[model samples]
Target: MEHPLGVQPQMGLFEGGADVAAAMRTRGLGALACLPDEALLNIMHELAPADLARLACSSRALWAFANHDELWKGFCLDQLEGRWDFQGCWQDTYLLGKQAKGFQPGSRKMRRAAGLQSDLLYTPWLCATCAIDPSWLEVENVDRRSGLSVAEFREQYEIPNKPVILTDVVTKWPAMKKWSRPYLKKAFKGGMTPACLPNCVVRRFDKTFCETAPQLAKDYTVPEVFSDDLFKLLCEARPDWRWLIAGPYKSGSGWHKDPNSTSAWNGVVSGRKKWILYPPHITPPGVRPSCDGADVASPVSIMEWFMSFYEHKASTRCESVGYTPAECILKEGEIMFVPRNWWHIVLNLDECVAVTQNFVSEVTLPHVLSHLRSRSPALVSGCAKEARSGLYDRFVKALKEHRPELLERVAAEEAAKKKRAQEQHKLAGLFKGPEDACPGVNLANGSSAANGSSANGASKPEASGSAAAAQNGTSAGGGFSFGFKL
Candidate 1:
């Protein structure tokens, strides 16, 4: 059946085998019940499998809430690694698997959900199926172009830090003709790489993996406009930048900026993608970044945001802010350039296949460096142990050794920024009522925004191993951990 968004969800196993969304309306668990699915997931995320199983036995209603397959998928990913071959669903698969910790697979009897049909239960099922409202798309489109040279692209979009849809670019990619579900499945049939299904793995599209999966990597090349990624100076130490993305209609991330203050290019190889983007300055409705910016809170699913906030709330925000979002329905073989720190969400119009790569270039080199230097190691994505701590130093050292010219430019830019900040501070001080405190650092001057931007603006990307990995937080705009959706 068609959903309000005009697409039907491909039927699959265990789609509505949860009571989470129904609880959103009924307060089935009293104060703890009927919250948004993300709130429920957050609470469940802290519970162990044993605890969840215990909750299942509390009552028939909580049984439905606790037995969610998505929860178990997360538990499986957290406790184990590699392929998940489900024996009915993730819960049955993990508990029955040898790696199961506290419970045997299928050890506990699940209460049969018999008379639980309602619009409320359908709420969870609709989240399982299709639910996006077509009316959510009341916004303007980004700029579009064809046959633009690299210099023109930089002048019009990159340097100005604006998003644009490259109308004709992806038509040249071999992926537009070659990639699809059966073909991708067959390409990795030899299993040189463990093919991922439900819980996807972030394939590092580096040299070795490219040589092994030449068929996949050779399908597309980075468009020249964004090929100047200065992060290449860090060599292999660079974060996870490219991803192989696929999902059903409505399966995508919450609103977020790219991590490490990098810009991006996303090209669809198959199916259409719907995109809504807010500029670096405009945070989308229902999205909140923590004070430290180490965490970003957003609606649990793409559909929820569009349904709950896209109309009046978004319009009111836009009217108050005097700006609107840049939006589009990206068709097959069409690519998008997402500028640095732009808040964006990509929803699939159907089963879609795509590749997105994050990058840093002259336009954003200074901002990227500042972020790496200031943020806590825990908030950074795609580094391990010592590499994480020394990332900023390593990038700088590499830039100084090789791209000395770029480093010099970055230094000049930083100096100019400080000068601007100091001027703004001095101007503000003219209006200052004598509280006799104007330090050289300008901390007491109260107009520090002129001097420089902070790294706290970037979203903390949840890397591999959680079921909700891709739910709200994003890294490079897509990725997840142990059954977590990235």
Candidate 2:
């Protein structure tokens, strides 16, 4: 259909050059003017920063399109490489980074749109406000266990590689009562260091937030089930482990595994969080993680993943089969155990505050060791500088000196595994039976000895092909078969 504003839907808005753009301007964007911000942003996405900035100068509509933070953010990143020195939105980063060295930013004023709902601007708000259908919560399931002893946990879920929500684990944490957003905002009075800012370094933002205010660290303690963190052997030199995560609705992590092949526990302080977890073997729908675990190719936004793939996953996911993922709402004061390297994504259903820690455990030590040794140092993370440089060797050395029992147990386990393998090799082709059957064995002609058969006497003819198989109990190819007539 022709656009009411006379735009040919087939033609791009700016395809024919400045004259064409001027004509479109005089003619107005027509249907393009009426397009949803997202679709219009898609058109604007094709433009270069200079062209986009020029377009912003042309008119209010184009200015709105051109000034989007996302557009500038993409430009900010594509324009530079390595650690970002600037902090703020991509537009601010671009302006900040583009300034001459030692540039001192001045007091700047931000232009306020009078309730303009640009898809470039307001769609994120819409995604945040979109009501989560109740049925969305009921599609999949994971077991919920509480009051499990360490042995019970290891024997049942940890060893079996399953995800579970532990209800009573974090119930007594002081953070559960004290760590509201308002309290946190007050507790977090100081500004974050340059390294803690988003797009900076490898540490979690939550840890950075807590590091800025050391008092916040006292609000929670490690649960008994996870108190066996092997990283503690490295003490102050261990990699950053715990974090204080807080976010508004519709904000949370994308698909990822925890760092350094460590299992994790996320204990919610307040509000609701929806968790969707798949085992180590199953990658969540629409996620493509590189094999070495460095880069992820998937929708960076939680809303994008939900809007694009969640329903399809829910509909096709089967609880009794491979596609089903463990799904749950982790409410206030609850702790969730995410096994090592299991793929998971967490979405906040409300304003939320939580603490999460990734730690190496006895169950995951070997896996972490293999990951540390096999991956390049650049890809390895979640540790101090000295540990990061030679994590596998350092960890093994620490294990031998301080935690020799762990190594001894693992060595014994390895020896047992090798013994099982040897036993399997010895019995490769044998099965239980009362006696052996021999083919082409005859007591009168010593056919049994000639055919390497030890069995009751039997006579065999020189039948060939199918005839041999039928009369002499021989293979169709004329090879002797083992048989015995009891």
Candidate 3:
């Protein structure tokens, strides 16, 4: 029903202006205390951020409910659209004060000394001569014929949040075949430089590597390799990868998670690389130690932390406590599988040709969608004070009721699967090498062969070809594969 102001009563205030304000001060506490927990949450949800902050300050009971992480999480998810940049937040909230304390009158050397140093420990070895244009990269829509049907591929390969080798595409590009270590060094020596910020490039130590190469350049930009048509197609076909080619001397992209709520795959064709992975679920406790403890004072990026521990002489002691991070080296023709939501840092060991794509595959869409839906209330409420308070309360209730079981199940399943895989691998080692020496397989010539053949015949072949095609009949080649049994 419409209220006197022509708005629905539920959407409008029914009480008088002064009375409502007074009631908020006097009865608000009682209302918060007396309301059933769920209803109280619902009411808080109807309030705005200012009102929520006010409620938080009113009393210990309100404060407890207001400051509950569930409330802030929901507030963040809803209002911020899950795009809270930790670095940006740190800059605004903490770095300003830190920088101010160190400020002094003009001295270029001192100013340079005080500036934030690159915290990246492991840098990707890139061809030093190439230039990269950041503007050349754009998000793309999916194409139907690019190996896997977009939807089907997204289901099997993308959603499961595992990396896959994209064959045939870009393999014929000049960089894939020609951009080698020598070529990169020569280009850099000739004075090639990157055309834009945030572009990738290779750094070389010696002029000899540069003298032996062709297509020498000081730097390259995206405009040279990535055409508008190519960029548009990539953006359309694989909008998630955020595709960009590295310029000479630019390390493989710095360590960071893909922004689209999932993990990503970086497929290299001409170069070798190293990857350091930190399971997204793992969180280090206590204050993170600063790098060098004297010059660098801020918390280290997770990548710097892992690399420092990896390269340090005291590595054994770090590993003994299980603080040493997991690292993988991937070479050309090999695919590195990054699990969903894992934080990974990559270094290209040489001038490399690679395609990096982010995907939301079948296994991961539910989680991604749930994350998206959870942010809806924030958008619906705007940045109002009362509505925000209400949203926070609702979030706390949902956390109490829904999230714990899922977290526990995920943890248990991961533990069990790891244990089982280890056991199976150990058992399989006993039967390694020629079957002729395996007692079970060499029982008798005819008997062993006959029995083995029968056993092998009884089972199915390991599933091959595109995972998407295996699940559905659709193929990346725009054909279908069907099986017929008589």
Candidate 4:
């Protein structure tokens, strides 16, 4: 007989009463049914879903316990990382999960799912990618007890441009409880347009919900550490920069930096995401950037990129200190800080919903302003005009009102930068002509003579401490810095 859910029917535990009695007597134990209901339920809870279902067919006594909604509810909650509560019958949710996992590779229904190119459970790529673990992905975790104050965050992580997973930052967010699948589906009802990544290695569903949906703005607040979001103040011009990211299970984004050079923070409201990060200081060898800094040409997909770059070269390139990319999994209610110029790739472990924002703090504001002034003067000029003020004065005023000490820090840094520039200009005049330029001078120290041309007739990289500053805002061009992404 066919089972309704296609589940294998359970085997009979005691088809013959005499045999059951004989077995019990041989073991010198009473009948299993004689156990109390609480004990039976506890035992049933420990069984896997398949085994529990099989036990239901053994006898009428086990059938009642197996069908209990509480039993299945617990299973669903545990598997979902305790983020979702069953909205209706727990059996229905369990059956849905089971059916989702049951889809055969290349099945018609699986192929038709929007943005779902592969199943999380059945994909050969997922299995292979998760199998190989590399050592360089040693992600640093900073929790509440780490004493991660704003000053320390800037000095330790932000200024150095390193990735760190912040564990306790988003625990009190209103979105943690309010942003559910049902609520989001309703908010985005009639498919009120989302920015879809076209022909991307992984399907990414992005919608600029922060501007379109007023309700979301109320639900999601900026993290305290990144409260100085100058972009939000100027969002009227570049509305496309901010967005809400939602993708189905097995859907995610490819290798890319956050648009513009601004630093970003992504808070997962629910579900899980696997992040692969490459710091700006040490990128994988032979990574070719596309003309548009937004994308890259890779072997196949993001996962394949990792496999080919790290897994295949583990013996050589990966053995170097601080060479491995920072890899970590961000679960429900966790927020990740992605510093400017640091490249990252995201893959959803489940159907995921997250809120991400690009912001400029005092640590990064000078860089953002400098990038904007040079790269897109019109944009910077327009923002200042819109505020009915001068660009520098308005920014300074905003800083004074929100963070007075931060303003002082920016002023000090800018003064130091100007002095360095003047010194470099003075030194560059001393070394004129091809003869002086060709032999690369040791500019490792802060000297303009050290900026001599290389053997290939290209100018040697200067120790311009302001390079990071010049490319610190969200990008407005094909390449982020010097025709390269980051």
* lDDT to native, each model: 0.64, 0.63, 0.37, 0.54
**lDDT, candidate 3, 393-455, per-residue tens:** 443344346454543453455567667767765664565446455333433332223123322
lDDT of 2 by residue, 1-486 (tens): 221112222234454444553454434344576566568788788887667766666654455456666787677556754235545445556667777355455433433332233233544434544677686577547778888999988867665556788888678887777765456546766244222222242122466655677767787888888898898887776777887776656667889888777789999887688898865545577888675558889874787778778876633211213355678999888899897777788877776667889888777776676677654665688755445758777788899999998877776766776676577644532432333344333435434533434355444333222332323322121112111110
TM-score of 4: 0.54
TM-scores across all candidates?
A: 0.69, 0.65, 0.32, 0.54
CA RMSD of each candidate after superposition? 11.0, 14.7, 23.1, 17.9
Judge candidate 3 against the unseen true structure and give its global Cα lDDT, from 0 to 1.
0.37
**The candidate that achieves the highest lDDT relative to the unseen native structure:** 1
Return the lDDT, model 2, position 306.
82
Global local distance difference test of model 4: 0.54
The TM-score that candidate 2 achieves is 0.65
Candidate 1 vs 2: which has more TM-score: 1
Model 2, 454: alpha-carbon shift in Å? 36
lDDT of 4 by residue, 5-93 (tens): 21221224444344443343233223655554457667878999889877766543345456555678678756643233233445556
Off by over 4 Å in 2: 1-55, 59-65, 71-129, 192-204, 314-322, 384-389, 422-486
Backbone Cα, N, C clashes tallied per candidate: 15, 6, 57, 5
Candidate 2 C-alpha error for residue 311, in Å: 2.3
lDDT of 1 at 93: 74
